[model samples]
Target: MHFCTKFLIVITAFCSYSMELKQPIVSYILNKINNSEEGTNSRADPLSKNVEGLEKLLSETEALNQTEKIYTVEHLVKSNGYPIETHYVTTGDGYILRVHRIPSSPKMNASNGKVAFLQHGILCSAADWVITGSEKGLGFLLADAGYDVWMGNARGNTWSRNHTTLNPDKDAKFWKFSFHEIGLYDIPAMIDYALEKTGASSVYYVGHSQGTTAYYVMLSELPAYNSKIKMAANLAPIAFLNHMSPLFQIMSLFEPMGNFLANLIGINEFMPTSNFFKYLIGNKICAEDSVTEYLCTNALFAFCGFDYAQLNKTLLLFIIKYTPAGGSTRQFFHYGQAIHSDKTNILSDLD
Candidate 1:
């Protein structure tokens, strides 16, 4: 009798599971049959309508919500319900840069009224400041804190690849600039634009990596712009690279032959926004569920420190898609020169 009871219990559980699995299929079949019987004239099934409504709602919500992430800096800002403005500045040498601005925020009502210029590092764009989401992104945080934030993209990057005269795609002259031009031309144009628009005498300048390098260049080459800066903050400053990481140290060894390598690759604009990265790296290797995700993390660990606690595993996918956001071969070659010479000089006197 106990054996029979156990068998019954197993059979009952199986039947219940089968019903659960078959319900959706059964409903679909029934709906089709009912629709056919209705001679294609009846109003749509309410259930079907509800399901369609739900799907539409989800797509719309996802469009507005950037929790999943996006590639455009301005869209990323708007999706987070922040005010964003796109300003184009023509540099002294004719490089047209796309600058992003968060004019004000609900958090502080523009009470501070001071302009804060945030510049991105090598191979990056204005998007870098706002990619980490609103809560953590420097751009958003600054806006929330009452400062008018302006994020600048250096020339040869994804956004700033435009020029008044030359074409970025076909013209080698378009890609001829290094960070020196960025500091001399790009910074002054962006800073002057921001000040003109906001009517602020001087901006609170903040830079990261090559951004800091550009700031130093600006101050050194054009001392007149010094009066236009309220203060300066440099993050991970790239002033003196005498103690650069082993990875850069190895890469710098090829600085002498940088021109040869650049020619070999036919790389005028290096690593622009492309499908190669989006489909290959973003959707495949660096994807959260991908088996080869470690390659992404490990690569960062190799360049940056291997601090597990600091790594945001999910954010890696977004970073991979947006970054290597295009730069010139000369820009990187300059850094390689700096690493070799153990100096902050933009133009190497070693030649």
Candidate 2:
């Protein structure tokens, strides 16, 4: 057989064997417990708690499940001289988005009224650029430096989880997107809003990692955005995949199988990275009371929130905070496409 034909055979076998686990096992396990209960007087087995690390996992699960713990302006404004305000705008497709606006720094004044808008990659919200580690996040840092700043959360993250006309959870159309749609849709709406809100004609654009990937798609697909975007800076760019992480290497092995499993389930749905994050936070490594535990997920729970609650006080006092919203499978396809094409292109395959 030809080399290409041989490769296909291996991929076919891999796809046939991989297991797809999208359904929540927690609900299933709870149902099993309830079904086995004897009577009103009967209770869950006292020993149920004796399962290896169940209590610890449950506690961590509770912590990880939290949604949207924001760092208040009281914490943000005083620390940095710039005042911060939040904004919400609807997409052309009529999805209402949640965003952040940081006023320009008082130290410098410019007439052009130019500002920078920062965007995050898949499975991430605006908070990824703003919160956690060091007081001046990407958002505040730009604002405090005298450039007005706008931070955006792509659809499906906690904040942008609403629609002008379509509910993402209820409308299949809302979820029908690859980073292609994101680049084509979300970024423009954000730019128009930033310009209108800041009274600027054009703004500087900077995206890190996946953020940069979207920029390339938007620029190539909608050339107009290229003109609107003055100075697009792509950090750690991934237009192609020669330098992909080891994780993607594993994915390459199971791409055929994973694709089959993916189709069997549905679109925009894959094993959420949080399952892994939950595993880390809920296992013995769970340290709700410890600053170290909270920092570990500074990327995931940041959007779900980890501040000011009955949560491990360490989650609250971690002093520094940032949340990395998880990405959908569509984003990964965009990454894969860019890497495969050896240039940035719209995400058309996986949505």
TM-score, candidate 2, is 0.65
lDDT of 1 by residue, 58-119 (tens): 45544544543456888889988898999999987888889999998867754598889999
Top TM-score hit: 1
Candidate 2: worst 10 consecutive residues by lDDT? 299-308
Off by over 4 Å in 2: 1-49, 56-82, 105-112, 133-136, 170-173, 270-324, 337-351
How far in Å is the alpha carbon of 198 misplaced in model 1?
0.7
What lDDT does candidate 2 reach at residue 219? Answer: 82
Q: Candidates' lDDT values, in order?
A: 0.73, 0.56
Model 1 quality (TM-score): 0.77
